[model samples]
Target: MTEISTLIVDGILAVLLVSVIVVCTIVYRRLGTIKSGQAELRALVDQLNTAVVDAQRSVANLKTSATEIEGRLQIEGKKASAIADELGLITEAGNNLADRIERGLSGATAAKKQQAPAETSASKKQQEEILAALREAR
Candidate 1:
């Protein structure tokens, strides 16, 4: 009977040892899975960081281009203003010349009308011919 009791105790110890080994194997497998996922998570974080850095550089480049464009626009605006002022002066000079020509023609017609009655017959005939020629030219 004592020998039988010793065998039963040994069997129980063997069962406990087997259970411990099975639990250890399950824990080791779970840890290996976690390690694999950790590597993938690290790679994803690195990719996100690289994308952020690239975006920052693009923003800086855009800012530089905008500043350059603004400077060019200001320069063009100044040039356009100067051209407009020059055109205004040219227009004023043309108007003044046209007025002078109009006044000169009117004065010449008035002088001719005042002298027509005092002219001799031959001179009056010559003046008429000249007037006719002026009309045709006009």
Candidate 2:
């Protein structure tokens, strides 16, 4: 009976040892897979960091370019204002010249009505000159 008990105990111990070996093998394989996943995660984080840095540089350059364009637009705005002022002065002078020409023609017609036969060769030359001036102005 004692030998039979010892045999049963030994068989149980062998079975326990085999179970422990199998559990250890499974744990080792899982640990290997976790290590490979960790390495891939680290590589992905490095690439994301690099892309963030590049984006920051691009934003900085774009800001500088926008500032330069704004400065150019301001300069152009000043030049346009100056040109508008010059054009206003030119328009005013043209208006004054047109008024003078209109008044001169009206005065000449009134003088002709006031004195007809008294107008001499000199007066004829003057009328001719005025007509010539009017035509030239046109």
Candidate 3:
């Protein structure tokens, strides 16, 4: 009876050790899964940080481009204003020329009217002289 009791106690101890080993293996596997999940989370965070930096750089470049374009537009606007001023001066010159031509034509027309009666008397005397010469020739 004493030998039988000792054997049964040893068998129970063996079973308990086996059960504890299995529980420890399960816990270790769970810890490894948690570590793998943490690594994946860290990689995702790194990718997000890179994306944010790239977005900021793009915004800065766009702002610079916009500023340059605005400056160019302002320069073009000044050039257009200068061209318009030159055109206005040319238009004024043309108008002044037209006024001078109109004045000259008016003066010529008045002079011709004053000379018409004198020209007609001179023409009549020349015709009488021509008629006398023709009679002599005959």
Candidate 4:
């Protein structure tokens, strides 16, 4: 009876050891899975950081380009304004010259109606003077 009891005790201990080894194996596999997942998470975080940095850099470059474009636009706008002003002055001068020419023609026509036909030399001289004035205005 004593020997049979000892054998039974040894058998129970062997079973318990086997169960403990199985539980340890399961825990180790789960730990390994968690470690792999953590490595993947770290890699994803690194990629995200790189993307953010690149985006920031791109935004800075865009801002610089916008500033340069804005400066160029302002310069072009000023040049356009100056050209418009010059054109306005030219137009105003042309209108004045046209008025002068119209008045001179009307005066010559009235003078021709008032003068005798023998005063043709005087009319020709007046026309020459008007032509010289027109040339000088140019």
Ranking of all predicted structures according to TM-score, beginning with the best and ending with the worst: 2, 4, 1, 3
Give the TM-score of each candidate: 0.56, 0.63, 0.49, 0.61
Task: Report, for all candidates in order, the number of backbone clashes.
Answer: 0, 0, 0, 0
Off by over 4 Å in 4: 1-27, 116-138
Residue lDDT tens for model 1, 1-138: 899999999999999999999999999999999999999999999999999999999999999999999999999999999999999998788667655655665576568669675646775576557655554543
lDDT of 1 at 66: 100
Model 2, span 13-131: residue lDDT tens: 99999999999999999999999999999999999999999999999999999999999999999999999999989878876786687578667767886978576778667766776
- How close is each model in CA RMSD to the real structure? 8.4, 6.1, 16.1, 6.8
lDDT-based ranking, best first?
4, 2, 1, 3
Each prediction's whole-model lDDT (CA) = 0.82, 0.86, 0.80, 0.88
Best by lDDT: 4
Comparison by lDDT, 1 against 2, better one = 2
Candidate 3 residue-wise lDDT, 1-138, digit = tens: 889899999899999999999999999999999999999999999999999999999999999999999999999999999999999998788667656654555565457558664556564565456545544543
Q: Candidate 3, residue 62: CA error in Å?
A: 1.5
Choose 1 or 4, whichever is better by lDDT: 4
TM-score of 1: 0.56
Error of 4 at 100 (Å): 1.2
Worst 10 residues of 4 by lDDT: 116-125
